[model samples]
Target: MFDDATPVIRRRSPKSQRRRDGLIQFAHDFTSQNGEDGILRHIFEAVLPPNENGIRHCVDVGAWDGRHLSNTFSLLVGPKHESITIAHDQHNDGSWIGHHDSRSIWRGVLIEADPGKFRELQSLHEPLGNTCLNVAVSSNAVSESSLASILQKSTVQQTLPLDFDFLCIDVDGADYWLLHDVLTNTSYRPKVICIEFNPTMPNDLVYIPPCNDNLRHGASLAALVELAEMHNYLLVETTIYNAFFLPKHLYEQCFQDLVPDTSIEALHETTMVTSLYQLYDGTLKLWGCKKLLWHRLPIEEERFQMLPPSQRNFPFAPNITSTTTEISDPVVDISAYCQSQVTEPLHSRRECSSQLLEQLKSHGFALVHGTGISAQLCRDALRMTHLFLQEADESVRRSCMSIRDRARRGYSPINTENFASLIGEQGPNDLVRKFRIGSESSTESSLLQPNIWPAPSEHWDEETCDEFRSVVEAYYDAICIAANSIVQCICDGLLQEDEGLAASLDFLSSSNSQQSSNQRNGIPTTGLAHKTSILTLLGYQTGSRHTKKHHKKKRAVHPLVAAHTDVGVITVLLYDSGDCAVLQRQVSNSESDKGKFKDVVLPYPVPDDPIFVVNIADCLSALSHDTLPSTIHRVVPAEGSIPRNCLALFVGFDPDQELKLKEGKTVSYETWRKDRIAESQKVLRNRMSVSKS
Candidate 1:
């Protein structure tokens, strides 16, 4: 089966200069032919032990142009080439094996369907004694026969533990089926597998048949993981559109405690960038794991620029270049400018209500200085968050992901990790630590879901685990108390006959009474009412390269949170770093100050003080009919290696409850909330559809 003629390659000097002018000479050689050279190198280094010597064979399916973006390039031309030998073998048993050479044998079979590319591949590797075939790999017996013939010729099957070193599958349309057939029907399984995944689709376990060329060209990570498990493999790493799987037996020896169990939580500990969507069949689809397309592919950059503000998948906000100087003279103390009221200690309980209301009505936001919240409470929450995310193994954190509770009410890793491989910038994992103080469901028909949590043993000792739970619960109670006081203050300031706020207060009081009564009477209850609020503990890591270079505001801005108004009634934010919370005055479209509001950067509060930035939300603003503007604010991502943390208490009411308003007006908060959420979801859906198209 071997071709008689030897093909020659056109090689250039390592330091050769391009003949641009044909006059003067410079001493810089061209970059390598392989665009994915570095990534492949890193992957091999991780899989292969440091100083061992043996034959390393690989199979490159869809091996177009051989060295161009070839996953097996490093094995052929890297600095370790001298240690490797190459040859070809045709045994008496009618079997064919790609040849091998010296100290460390390196040989590979490159399969290319396109005739021109196959010729190029043959020419590139013929001199090295490797094999290149012009054939399409498929689930059909004919396609597999080529591989079966070659595998039997080699002693690779006898090389137990590592049948072959690496296998790269990239057939574009039928990769999943091909890999499945190879693993299930044949004995040649590589120690390491690098397969292309569908970056445009969701991460659901969806597999498309090879004949379905009209659908997505690749399989989802879910599908791949299922296949891997069936074939005695485990996913170890994921690039933009590629997943790396190693033999299940080899993972423990290579990575060990580096990777936790294969839970979604463990996966997130490695990277936080994900593109999520839901298919019509009700299965959630996801794309982009570890590396986002924004970094992996250049084509995404062009598309990202074309997306509108509402449709764009920004980690935070856009148009942050608007300056504060245009809206107001830079105030040294933004807290003073906001005219915040001191409502802590409850001092008289009823005495400080008016001051809180006036400040809220005038500035749209205010700093509430109180004794209820302490540094220790904030630290406890942040410490637990860091311990779960940074200190624990990735798998431990992944174990906490609750697919059923998609609002992700516990330890959720939101989009925080950078597309480091693509963008050359890597940041710490950004975990959105969530804790619920009340029921998650709104209606009676819905079952109330308890908070999702990580397994205690996954991260800490039993003693520390008990303390973690206690401290978090204590902080939850403290924030709830502080937030309740602010709600009462709002009720006192805005309503003449505040029955709605009184009813809410009554509900809380009666629920506590019922719980106490139930415990006293030995009757079981859900503890709190069917409606409650949430406290979001966020770790905003340093800004990514895109935010740093593109989104710098007059004041620093975090991309994790962008220029948008809060969705709830009121957001009580505890800022832990620099003047991170920036607020802009709401200017009506008819006013001269219309667009000018974008310029104002709300000033920072006194550092290390127990100052809670209380900002009014859309619900209150909608109820007031723009009389009380919902301030537009954003958290500017901190720069450099310095990470920032914040605790925000979102005060909300029963969605089903109707609001009693001024002039005998009545409104259902649920209706308005649904409309807003629907509109945003529509925009995002449209964007995803258009992007895929």
Candidate 2:
């Protein structure tokens, strides 16, 4: 607080810096505070002087319940907290009880604008003898006076000292303004400050005052840095939401040993121990500071070990070098690369209830031994697929061609070799009919959209169309039923605790109250209609006897579908084709980050032992934070003249709800879906323009 001179940080060699960064990435010593609550521990441990004990004092603005997602929790009561302690017969919280003797002593003042949350916050810190205020905080003179008065009263009443050790400001609105006022008008200066930073704001160092509650509300990173400098603080670490800063004096003294030099070169370079981890349903985040040493715990060490050797290598070099032992007859074990983490699929739904939960956690996808999905129904569905593409009249097939803006829906025949190589045979041979099933509105309140049933054609026999509709619809319903169970299995896997599951289900149910029962149910249905789940009928024509074989036979012989990950949560593949391949990434030390793809044959579904192959997709991986692997798979051209017919179902999250992550970061499914669609359209437009030229 007394220092006017810039702090000097210790300088380390490049090799030493790299080694220190590696240790932090491997150890999980401190968890992510902004993303979870681990990063705060790193911040506190780094700034506070060694051997200093007992509450230095902290103030948390916009403190909700003082525990869940709180940045000051680690400093207030210590990290390892238990509700029930046998040694100390204390009230629920072990604040003044069992572990208080060895506890890192600390006290805090929690302020929340919401009356209800403030009450809960008070109850949570009741045993700690900390003050919890329910009044709103603002930069206005009246609000500033009231806030100053509260601080004055707390200091006198509790006989606590002034000049807080830590300050956490995180009100949803006017966060920047209130923080600015505190720095400029108050005599209090926190040794360390953890405040919310707006990610949506432009990175340029401009300060935008909050006037509308609807807009993203927080100070920009550059703006916060400027503000902290004005208050004699040095910006230390920037997490997903919060920015950590240290008083200049504290920075020069306590942090020099851990933090690297703050020179221009060190500031611009990303030599800090940074990490990108997906919080539970949260946005992917980068963690750690360049200057501060990043500490890793045992759990993170185990996580690194689980990675392929290439990823596990130190220095994180793109081209990693490793020695290999050659085998007499090398045979790539496909199972080793893409098989379920578990040994076997569940035999029944009951088994799915018990075992699939563990499998989803480990493998991300599982095979059900007995799904009860009728093989005959699937065959009939395949027959309908064949009739729509090959047997149907020319006008009937043309009628289903997608219109101007609805390319994702209706019928689309493969035209280019790229399309053919990705999902079907080259040329206009492959026909796909995409049907949306459920409610029509794709808003936050309603994720369901009415199904766009294919119109009956006059050229086709009316009786045959009716029969086709009946059979296909029945099969669709059956797939939904099985998929629902799969969805439940995923929910169980993703949300292990009952409370987490209940909260998710409650959100889903409340969001779709006006929609059908299926909509209310937490099912994976997204990526198409930007909300509605998709059911596609794939008809890949290898060739027929009457078809011309001369011009380009290479198109048919090449990989029918190129390697790609599914866009949705999970994909249910139902087909009798033996000519498909699952593309599993094979990482080599010599290869770049994106490893080469290895293809393995996808076996045909046995008639007697009918099994539907379900693969975890991109949406689920994002939702699950990569806990489940999103299987990358593709179809290969059939060997015979008969066309390969298959049905695929893509399920995802409800569009209306935003993925609530730690540190107030959120991602809207609908927004992400729209962006993906826009990107795809741009690619298609460029491809079409090139072809026309």
Candidate 3:
């Protein structure tokens, strides 16, 4: 029934209609996007009535030519008078004061650092009752060009109110620092602040690049929000690149209805979707701008990555795609992977394949069996550990006592360690004697202390002590080799899975190589040396003095080693025990099985083939974004069981290697390790005090 030439009318919704009406009433564009100029005009009209005789002051840093992309230019020129040209002589000093004009009530200070731009700014603002400064504003209070110093040089300094009406900062670089200084050091607290922010950054990312005069790296909106809150300001609105903040008291009085939601997410949601993201394979995806706007460098570099290359894989991607769609690959069942047996020969590096990587990713452990580390070598190490513990006299034990402040590289007597306290559980002290060893020669000898070996005594001869030291050193070297091979295999597997990860890893490796070379050349590097990794020989003596003390307390079970996660990258454990002594906590969905500890069974060694159990430790788990879990395990012997011995090589990154955790905190490996150790010790001390009470 409709005519062929009839035009269809589209009805606007109530919300859209209101927006349209608003635009018609207040959409004046004076070099500002998103109607910022009109908004500011309305705000000023409401707060500072033009009818009053009071003179309102404004400050504009980085005011280019005083008009182009200027926030205060419209306010200076006023809404009524469109054309008014007047020539005025410049003052002898670098400052120019304009004649009073009846058309405008705002008196502003326009500052531009560039010499050429300052000339244009003076020519434009000198006739409009405004002050123009040619000096750059410094955030440092001590600097000669500081805002306070510069303001003192101007004629308007006497008239400028402590609580100024408006302040606009668009210096691009050091905007945050400048504002912070203005609020903290000086008495001036502007009623409204219009600051520039990097629109390309994510809403949650709180990044403030180092302040440099030559660099124009802008601060993030989130950082500005935090700074505003610190100074009793509430974020009211945001354009694409600028955020508007109002004093909390003023906002509460008049602007509550205007901005119902003052949160950054509500105001700038569209601009907050970051261009950078990560794929399931640890591949970074640059969705929008690939280059840094100010630095003119590619953002795909390793330094800009949210997480380290080793941690970018699935389940570890801090910023992933927004969609809920799964990857094309089949989903891996964690339970099946936990139960799967991944075994490789220690001698053959090629056998450490994807299967082992998968098992490590799921179950956090794998087994290496072969002639690379002969059965005889393991037996000899275990025998020496037992002999050293049993034969060492009190004097020898005291001489080798561990220096708690340094790298614990000596002897720790029985009943000294209570690892279960780390997980908030109180258990009997471990009935174990430990001897730790590190590289004999180290560049930083103070940090990595020298190993202390038992000298010739009544229990052992000089020749026997020499043989024991030789066996321990040989075992340490062999385990280090196996650990290096396993790490290389893991890196190779990750590279194979995702080629993007290889580039980042390569970049990191090249950086580390350069740092290592610098250290070798005595360049005074800050990173820790690679020789700081430790090897611990654990001897669980049955019916010992510590065990007797524990038995007298009538505990249900004898815990040789309490439940705790290892502190390094990976632990290569070689134990001489027929029974299943190590128990690992198997996390399950079933309510009844939850938190239960399951036995970790080791395969019987055949002839010359010795087996090494490799488990993921805390550092690797953190670096890998928990794609590999740090397995929580403990050593507890069965009733009527004989003594057991274990030689565990705890491999770690160079002490100086800095790691960024998932929560966006960066800390050195050594510091991280020391903190964990300190926490464990504190808990142990607390538990010990409680037990004594």
lDDT assessment of candidate 3: 0.65
lDDT of 3 by residue, 271-329 (tens): 33435555665556555556766568766444344432212235543442232322212
Q: Which residue pairs in candidate 3 have backbone atoms (N, alpha carbon, C) closer than 3 angstroms, thus clashing?
A: 528-656
lDDT of each: 0.52, 0.52, 0.65
Regions of model 3 farther than 4 Å from truth? 1-351, 391-396, 403-407, 441-447, 498-530, 544-555, 578-593, 604-607, 663-665, 677-693
Q: Give the TM-score (vs. native) of candidate 2.
A: 0.39
Top of the candidates by lDDT:
3
Error of 3 at 35 (Å): 99
Measured with C-alpha atoms, the lDDT of residue 535 in candidate 3 is 86
Please identify model 2 stretches exceeding 4 Å from their true place. Answer: 1-365, 404-407, 416-458, 497-531, 543-558, 578-609, 661-664, 676-693
RMSD of each: 20.3, 28.1, 26.4
Tens-digit lDDT string for candidate 2 (396-482): 666655443233445655532233222212233222333333334644343454444456667777787678667766766666555
Cα shift from native, residue 449, model 3 (Å): 0.9
TM-score-best of 1 and 2 = 1
In model 1, which regions exceed 4 Å deviation? 1-351, 416-448, 496-530, 543-558, 578-609, 660-668, 682-693
User: Tens digit of lDDT per residue, candidate 1, span 567-666?
Assistant: 6677776533322223344453345554344323322222233456677877666655455567655443433343345556676666665754444556
